[model samples]
Target: MNQVNVFLRQRKDHRRWVALFLALACVVAYATLDRLKYNGQALNHKQMALVCTAHGLVAHEHNDDCYDEDGELRCPLPELELHEHDDSCYEEMAALVCNELESDGHIHDASCYERVRDEEPSCGIENDTHEHSDACYGWHEELICDIPEGEGAHHHGLGCYEIQMALACGLPEITEEHVHTDDCFVEIDMTPDEVEELVEERGPRRTPSWPPCAARTRWSIPPS
Candidate 1:
């Protein structure tokens, strides 16, 4: 009887040990599954971040792609097409007007007019004490010895006379029959040939075109 009781106690202890081991295994499996789930979520978020960065969609505010989707953000590649040249792309150019030098109906010279001199007469006597004689008589009142105080007079022999000098001539005056020279021509801007050459070299002026892929959009998988 005691042997049977001991056998029964041993069987109960073994069953308890088996239950504890099974419980420990279940706990470990649950914890491992939870860690794997968390890691998977983190990896998915990192991959989405990389995709957004590659497509230049990191800034959500400035991009229209961020709001095009129904409930999530989507990034798409740009579509492009080659555009040919057209006349509408260029602005209208006006015809060029060139100016040239021409004669202004005038002439220049170094000698066109002559100079003139004036003269006056005085008594031919030598001493200031000589009295009025026939040489000083019958002359103009201005040529007489009675000179004004500030009349710029000097005594020559027995007379007082005013001497005047002439000034040197300056630039010549214009005449009625003047001839045109290179100096008489008016200055001008660019010539017509020069303007034509510039136009040929520059070809045509063009207005700026719209950017590539500016009018289109595409769709892709929404980021998690």
Candidate 2:
């Protein structure tokens, strides 16, 4: 009888050990899933939901622009809800924009400026001072800088200007006789035939289809 009791007790202990192992496994799995959902890498619906919720952009908040007609979560605001996950968020200050890398979730801190662009003035200033060089231009009080390609620079046709510096842009004077360039127009050094081909190849987007359906020059600006 005593021998039988020992065997039963040993069996009970074995069962207890199994149960404890299973409980530990359950806890580990739960913790792992939580980490993945909030890791801040490539986000999915559930992960993005958590982020949007924190920012009050989830359902009926101020900027409730989430969800298209298809019920997809689209975060449109510059500072979307990824700050907790990625640990970095894109925020627009008074005149400047800033980002935090933690929102990216380095959970290591990083600089938003370094990750976003090649240098300070991607507006095309090569130096730190951001002076008006060949690539940078001034329109009214605003800076009308050129975006540099390999050899040349181009301005995307963002038609917001105050007309501060005219002579600085010596392509063609805006006067009736000269017309340095028309509104949102740029001068190309290409021959007329080449310019026509480029316009055609660019399709109707660069040049609008409403009035002319044509691009006039090689110096085309990008769309905002």
Candidate 3:
């Protein structure tokens, strides 16, 4: 009877040891799985930091945050911030920065200046302020009459007229029958020398016997 009791006690002790060993194994397995999970998360964060660094951004390890050079946060996507500018000036890109600068009232570049100049109003003539006549055309900064070149066009004050009127006023031969008047002349700033030079260059100057009015009338309705 004493031997049997000792055997039973030994069996009970072995079963207890087996249960303890199984419990220890389960605890070790749980700890190992938890450690692996932590290591995977750390590796993912490291990869994100490396990606941010490659895109010229600052990466924070504590919170895995990324920021641009201007201190603006651009986490999870640094590429989107690459083309953005802080001062609204897109110098790197080949896009027009005119609208942005104009809205902010900032100085413009060469291209923007040209765009503004092209958008200005113009009347075909530079600095033209006066009304133009039907027979005149815009010439540089002045409105000039479209008088035929060889038909005796001469400048008088700020106008152009036929050469016959100029000759009738006071030239080589003064006709007693023809009298000079403002109606027969076009106001201009032309000199006698300039008229003479023009005449020499374009054939000879024509001389008229009648006054400018009579000549105009005769030329308009030929003698029947």
Instruction: Please report, in order, the local distance difference test score of every candidate based on alpha carbons.
Output: 0.39, 0.36, 0.37
Candidate 3, residues 1-224: lDDT per residue as tens digits? 99999999999999999999999999999999999987765554322111221222322132214442344333432121122223323122222212121122233344332211223334554455765443244333322334433443322221221222111222122222222223333333334455446446857323223222222111111112
Query: Which digits, one per residue and each the tens of the lDDT, describe model 2 over residues 1-224?
Result: 99999999999999999999999999999999888866533232222121222222221222334443345434323321211212122221122111211122222123212322223333554665656543444322322334322323233233422122111221211111111113312233444455458547855432111122221222222234
Native-structure RMSD, model 3: 42.9
Between candidates 1 and 3, the lDDT winner: 1
Sort the predicted structures by TM-score, highest score first: 1, 3, 2
- Which candidate comes out best when scored by TM-score? 1
Expressed as tens digits, the lDDT of each residue in 18-132 for candidate 1 is 9999999999999999999877755543211112322221112223433222433333222222333333333322221222222333232323323322232245665779765
| Predictions: Cα RMSD each | 33.2, 35.7, 42.9
Better of 1 and 2 by lDDT: 1
Worst 10 residues of 1 by lDDT: 214-223
- State every prediction's TM-score relative to the real structure: 0.26, 0.21, 0.23
What is the TM-score (0 to 1) of candidate 3? 0.23
